[model samples]
Target: MEFSASKRIIHGFAPAFALLLLGSLAAAQSPKKSDYLENIALCNGPGHTSLAARIGGCTAFIDSGQGTKTALAIAYNNRGNAHTINGDVDRALLDFDKSIKLDPTYAKAFNNRGGAYLRKGEYDLALQALDEAIRLKPNYGRAFVNRAGVFLKKHEYDRAARDYDEAIRLEPNLEAAWSGRCWTRAIIGSLQAALEDCNKVLQSWPNDAATYDSRGLIHLKIGEAAAAIDDFSAALRVDPKLASAFYGRGLAKLRSGDKAGGDADISAAKAIQSGVDDDFVRYGVRADN
Candidate 1:
C-alpha cells in the first residue's frame, strides 16, 4: 500500500501552499468601497495574500456594470488570485492569461501564472513567468520568493537562500518568505538558522502543525532525539492526521530506545495511508537509515 513518495510528500506539504519542482499549492473583514480599495491597494501593493481576497471581491463588483477594459483586467487579475488560493491552478492560469490579454503589462498576473507553472513542474515556464514578473515589478518580493522555490527544487540551495534573504529584506515580517527561508536553510544543513526562522513564524502565528513538524525535523537533525519526539508529538496533537508527524515520532522513539513504540507508530502511519516516500524515509532518524 506504499503510494508514490512524491504523492505522499505532496500530501504532507499540501496545506503549506509551497510548490516543489515535483509538487504544491486564509481570513476576512468587511469595509466600505474606499476601505476596500485601500485594503486592495495595500494587499496587492505589498504582495500580501489579502490581495487575492480583495481582488476577488472587487472583480465581482466590477462585473456588475460600468466595467472598462482596464477594470476587467484588474478583475481578472484579482480573480486569478482567488483561484490560486483555492488551489485551482488551471483557472488561475486562465485568469492570468486573460488579464495579460487585456493589459500586456500585468506583472502580478505573470508572477502568479509562473507560480501555477511551478506547481505543474514546468520549471522553464515557471522561470519565464517569474522573469517577466520581476521585469514588470523590479521590487516585487513575492516574485523573488516564487523564484526561490524553483531554485530549492533544483537543489540550488545557496541561490534559493539568496533570494529568500532578498525577500526578507523587502518585507521583514512576511511569514511565507520567512518559512521559505527556513525550509531552504534546512535543506542546506543550516538547522540553527532554520530553527530561528521557524521561531519567527511561531511568534507571528504559533501552533502551526507544519511548523512543529518542520521543527521536529530540525531537532532530529541536530541529534535531539527527545526534543524531536516532543515536537512531533505536539504536531500530532495539533493535527492528528499528519502522517509525517507519526512517522517522525516513531523514528525518534525507535532511535531513543523505544523500538516497540517506534514500530507501533510506523504501523499507525501506514494505516493512516499505507503510502510512504523514500525522501520521507530519508527524514527518519539515522538509525532508521
Candidate 2:
C-alpha cells in the first residue's frame, strides 16, 4: 500500500528460537563435519528466520571445509538470513550476494536478495531479483510470494494478486500467500472473497493475530461494525500491541455509536503507532457520518 511510510511493506520475522539454541549447544560440544553441516542446514532453513544462533551455526559450518558448492552456497545464504534477522541488513545483503556468486543459478539466494532489497526500499531492484529467482525456479513459491510483496509495496494491486495467486498455486498450503492475497483483496477487490481467504488462514493458524486484524478490516469495510469490533478484540487478545487492531476497533466502535470507546481506542492505537490510520485511509475507509 502507498501508506507504507507508516506501515512496513513486509511484516514479521517468522522465527523458531528454542530448537536453534538447543541444537547449537549440543553441536558445540561435539563438532563433527556431519554435525556442522547439519547446523548449516537448519540455520539457513527455508524460513530464513534470521536468529543469532543460526548465524553462529552457519559460521561454524563455513569454517569447516564445505563438501560441495551447493553446501557452501547454502551456508552463505543461511548466514545472510541470520544477519537479516539480526538487523544487520548490510551484512545480510553481502552474504546473499556471495551466495549468488558461488552458485550462478541459486534461486533462493536471488529471492533472499530481493527480500533484502525490500528492507532497503529498493523496490525496482527487489522486483528484478525476484523475477530472476522465479525464472530460475518456476516452482519457487517463496520467490513468488516475495514478488507479490514488492508489487504490493508499489501499489500494483492486480499484479500483487496475480503473484499471490501463483504462490498459492505452487504451494497450496503456504499460509503467507493466502494471507497476502486476503490483505490485498481487502484493499481493492472482493470483500467476500477476502473474508473467505482470511477464514481459511485462521482455520489453519487460529492464533494469528495479524490475520484477525486483517479480517477485522474486511468486516469494517463491509459495514459489519460489530463484527469488526469483535474480530479486532480477538486480535488484541492474541497480541495486545497490535496498533492496527486498535485503530480498526476504534472505527468499528464509532460506527456502532460508541463514541467514548471509539475515541479511547483511537488514542491507544496512535500511542502505539502514530500513523496507524493511514493504511485504512489509503483503503478508502472513513469515519461514519
Candidate 3:
C-alpha cells in the first residue's frame, strides 16, 4: 500500500499582470480600496506565502464585508487551504463548509474538503466529498487522485488503479497520479506497468521519495535485491524517516545475505512505525522470504 498523503488541490490567483493592474487601481483609489486589493492579493498568492499570512489575508478579505458572495466564497476556500496546510484540519473543514454553503458548485472547495478528510482518516467522508467534487467537475483530475488515495487506504487497489487511470487520462503530466498508479499497480502485481509509471515520475521529479520507495518495492518483488536496495536507499536519502524505505531496504539486505544490516534496518523501521512490517506483509513482502 502507498503510504503517501493525497495531494491537496488549492485554487491559484490570476496572472502577475492582473495583480499589477490591481496595484495601479489601488494607487488611484482610497486607502480602503488599496487595503482590500492588497488583502486579496495576499490571500490568493501562491504557495510561497506563509500559512499564517495567507490565513490573515483571507480573514481580512472575508471580514471586510465589501466583497461579492462569490469572492467571499473564494476567500473562505483560500483560508481553508491555509488552515489545511497549517495542520488545523477541523478549522479547515469549517471554512470549507462555509465556502460550500456560499457557493454550492465550488468543486475546488469540495476537493479540498475531501483532502482534509483524508488527512483526518475519515475515509467515508473523504469519499463523499471527492465524489461530489468529481460530479461537479468531471474533468477534475486532482479530485480523482484524492479519491484514489481513499481507495488506496481502504485497500481497494483495483478501484484506486481505475481512479488513477482516469486522473492520468485527464492530466497526463500529473506526477501524483503517476506515482500513485505505480504504487497501486505494484501491490496488484503489475510489475512492468508499475515500473513504467515510477520511471515517468522519476524522470520529472527525481527527488520524490514515495516514487523511489514504490520502485524499490517493484525491484524487491522481481527478486532484484541489489536494485531494490539502491532504490530504497535513495528513498531513505530523500526522507530518512520513511518507514517503508527502511523496511524495504531491510528486506533487500536480508535477501542479499546481510543479516546484521537487515536486522538493524528492520528495527529502525519498527521504531519509526510499529506497523511498518504489517504494511510490507500486505504488499506480499516478508522478512522470512
Candidate 4:
C-alpha cells in the first residue's frame, strides 16, 4: 500500500498544477532562441520508452554543439524525468546520477532521483535523495510533498500529516499536495477530512477529472450514492475519455437499482478500456447511460 501511494505520487504529478506553474513562469522570462533549441534537444525521446537512449542522444548533440553545461544538465534531468515516468527506475536513477554529476548542486536532479528510489520501494534511499534536495534548496515544496507521501505509504499518518501540513504551509497553491493529503486522509479512514482536501483541490482546478473521481470514491465510502454519482458524472463530463468515471458511476447506479444504466456505464467503461477491474464493475454505481 505504501508502495502504491508512492507510485501514484510519481506517476501522477498533477499535470494541471505543473501547467499553472509554467504559465506563471512564462510571464517572467522570455527565453532566448538558444533556450528553444535546448528545449527541443531535451525533448528527443523516442516513443517514450527508451528515455535513457534519448538522453544519451541529446547529450551527444549538446556535446557536439558548444552547448553549455546547463543545457547538458537540463537534457539529463529531463531524460531522467521521462525514464521515471516510464517506470524505468534504474535508468531514471542513472540519468539523474549523470545530471547531478554534471551539476552537483542540481536540486531537481536529486529530487527526481528520490522519486525513482521511491518507486523502487527503496524508502531509505528515497529519503536520502530528498534530504539532499532539501539541503540544497530549503524551499523545495515538491520534495516535502514527496517525502510526506512516503510517510503516508509507511502508514506513519501523524508524520505524513505533519509533512503535508508543512508542504501546504510552504506552497498554499500546490494542488498535488492537497490531493496527497486527501489520499492520506482516506487511507487513515478520515473520510470527511479526505473529502475536504479533495474539495480544496477541485476549487483550484474545477476541470480536473481525477479530483472528481477521487471525491466520488470518498462519497462511495461514506455511503452517499447520489453524491458519488454526481461526482462521477462531473468527472465524465470533464473528460469523456476516462474509463474509471464510467466504472465508478456504474457502481453507484447498481447500488441505486438503475440496472440498465449501470450496465451501460460498465459497457462504456469496457469499451474505452477492456482491462477495468471486475471489482469495479461489480461495486461501482451510476445512473442509466
Candidate 5:
C-alpha cells in the first residue's frame, strides 16, 4: 500500500522586521507598519495557529498593498497552505496559482500547487507542478516525495522508488521518505531492505500506523505469520480503522491454520473497506493461499 507523501508548506518569507524594529523605533513606526508586522506574524505563525486566523492574516496582508511582489507571493502561498489544511483545495489552488504568477521562481508555491493537485487526484498535473518545483530547487526533498506519491498513484513503482531514494538522500531524517521507501521496497520484493527501513522509522516514530502495516505485510511475505500478526495488531492499536491491517492479519491467521479467526478478520476488513481483499490480491496474496 502506498501511503500519502508528507506535504510540507513553506511559511512566510517576511524579513525579521520585529527583530530590527524594537522599543521606541517600533513605537515610532506608523500604525500601518505595526499592523503589517502583526499580520505577518499571524500569517506566518507556528503550526498551532488557527486556520481561519492564518487565512485572515494573509488576506489582510495581501489587501494592504504594502508588500513587495515576493512578499505578496509568500502571503498567497501561506494562505493557500491554510486553505489546503482547511480542506478547501480549490481555493488553495487559486492562491497557489496567484502566488506562482506573482513569482514564477517560487519553488515552494509550485510544490504546494502540486500537493493541491494531488489532493484532487490529478496525478498528471501534480507531476507537472512537482517537476517544476524540483527544477526550480533541485534539492527539494519534499517535492521529490510528492512526485513519488504521484508515481505511486500511477503504479509506477520503480519511479516512485527512485524518487523516494532521492528524498531519503536529501533528507535522511524524513520519516515519510523512509516509510515510503519501505513500502515500495516491500512491494518490489526487497524484503530485507524494506524491513530495515521500516524498523528505522519505527525507532523514531513508534506510533506510525502505516509503517506498522507495511512491516506486517513484510513479515507476512517472509512467512513469519506470528510476527506479521503482531505488527498488524500494533498497527490496529494505533489506527483501528486501518482495513489493510485487518486484511493482512487475516491472511496471517489463515496461514497459521486459525481458519475461523482468519475468516472473522477478513469479514471485518471487508466491512470496513469492501475492496481491501482486492488490494491484498494485488500484493500477491490470495484468500486460498
Candidate 6:
C-alpha cells in the first residue's frame, strides 16, 4: 500500500475578506460604484468549483482600481486557485508567485506553492516552501503534514512520524496525518499501533483502498494471514487498479498455502508495475514463495 501526501491544497492562498461599501443607499447613488463593490464581493467569495465566475469576478475587481496591495494580492491568489482547480498548475504557480511578491509573509501562498511543487514530484523544492510556510505560521498543521509527506518519500520514517505527531497535535482531525503515521508505524514494526490508526481512519473513510492495504500489511506482520488476505481482498474490491494490494494479497495467499492464487496475484501486480517483485523483496516481505 502507499500513503498519499496532500494531493491538493486544502484552502486558498489568501485569507478571506470582504468590502464594506455596499448598501442600498450607496447602490442607489452610483451604478459604477455598485458594480465595483459587487465585483469585489464576488472576487472575495470562495472560488472553489466555479472557476470561470471566479476568474471573471477577480479580473473585474482587479481592474476596478479600488483595492490595497494586500487586497489585490488576495484577488490574484483567488484567481490562481481557480486556475489550479481547473487543472492548470502553471497558472496556479504564476498566481502564487504574484501573491508571494505582494505579501512575502503570506503563509498560505507558500503552502499552496509547496503543494504545487509536491504534485510535480520536486520534493526538495516542496520542503523549502513548506519550511518557509511553517516558519511564517508555526501552527500551520497543513504545512507540517505536507513536509512529513516529503520525509516519507525520502524514507526518513522517524522524521515523518514526528511531523505527523506535530500535525495531529495542531489539527486533531487531520486524516492524512493519521494515515501517514500509520504507514510509518508499520514500516517501523509497530504493527498494533498501525492497525489502530488504520482502523480509526477507516471509520471515517470506510471505502479507502489505501488504508485497507495498510491494515492488511499490519495483519500480515502479526502472522494473521487469513485476516490479511481478507483485508487485501477488500482493498482490491475498492480499487482494482491498486498494484500494492495485489502484491500484498499474494503474500498473504502464499502464507495461507494458496500457491496458485499467490502466483497469479504476483504476476498481476508485476504487470501493473514492472519490478514490483524486486521492490517487495527489497521491502523484506516474503515474496519468494
lDDT of 5 by residue, 21-90 (tens): 2334443476767677778877775557799988998898788766677778888888998898788999
Candidate 4: segments with Cα more than 4 A from true spot: 1-61, 65-71, 86-89, 120-124, 236-251, 258-289
Local accuracy of candidate 2 as per-residue lDDT tens digits, 1-289: 1222112233222233223333334454664746764665566554544376677777776676543566667678877766765678789889888888988898878888888888788899999988998899999888888888888879898998998899899999988788888888998858899999999999999987777888998999888999999999998999898888898999999999999999999899989887667766777687543
Clashing pairs in 2: none
Worst 10 residues of 2 by lDDT: 5-14
**Per-residue accuracy of model 3 over 180-252 as CA lDDT, tens digit each:** 9999999999999999999999999999899999999999999999999999999999889888899999999
The regions of model 1 sitting more than 4 angstroms off are: 1-65, 267-277, 281-289
What TM-score should be assigned to candidate 6?
0.81
True-vs-predicted CA distance for residue 99, candidate 2, Å: 0.3
What is the C-alpha lDDT profile of model 4 across 1-289, one tens digit per residue? 1124333454212121112222223422545445544434444453443655555555554454434556556566777777777667798788788888988988888888888888887888888988898899888888888888677556577777777778798888887778777756755668898899999988888886777887887787677889989999998888787787787788788888888998898789889877665434233322332
Q: Better model by lDDT, 5 or 6?
A: 5
Summarize candidate 6's per-residue lDDT along 230-253 as a digit string, tens digits. 999999999897788899899899
Roughly what TM-score does model 1 have, to 2 decimal places? 0.73
Better of 1 and 5 by TM-score: 5
| TM agreement with the true structure for every prediction | 0.73, 0.84, 0.93, 0.65, 0.89, 0.81
Question: How many residue pairs in model 3 have overlapping backbones?
Answer: 0
Cα lDDT of model 4 overall?
0.69
In candidate 1, what are the lDDT values of residues 1-289, reduced to their tens digit?
1111121111000111111111111011233445434433432433454645555555544444434566556666666666666677788788889978987887777877777777777778888988898898887787888888777666677988998898789878666677777766766788899999988888886876777777887887787889989988987888787777787788789889999998888788877865543446433335445
Best by TM-score: 3
Name the runs in model 2 displaced over 4 angstroms: 1-50
Q: Show where candidate 6 strays beyond 4 Å.
A: 6-15, 19-67, 79-87, 278-283
lDDT at 289, model 6: 41
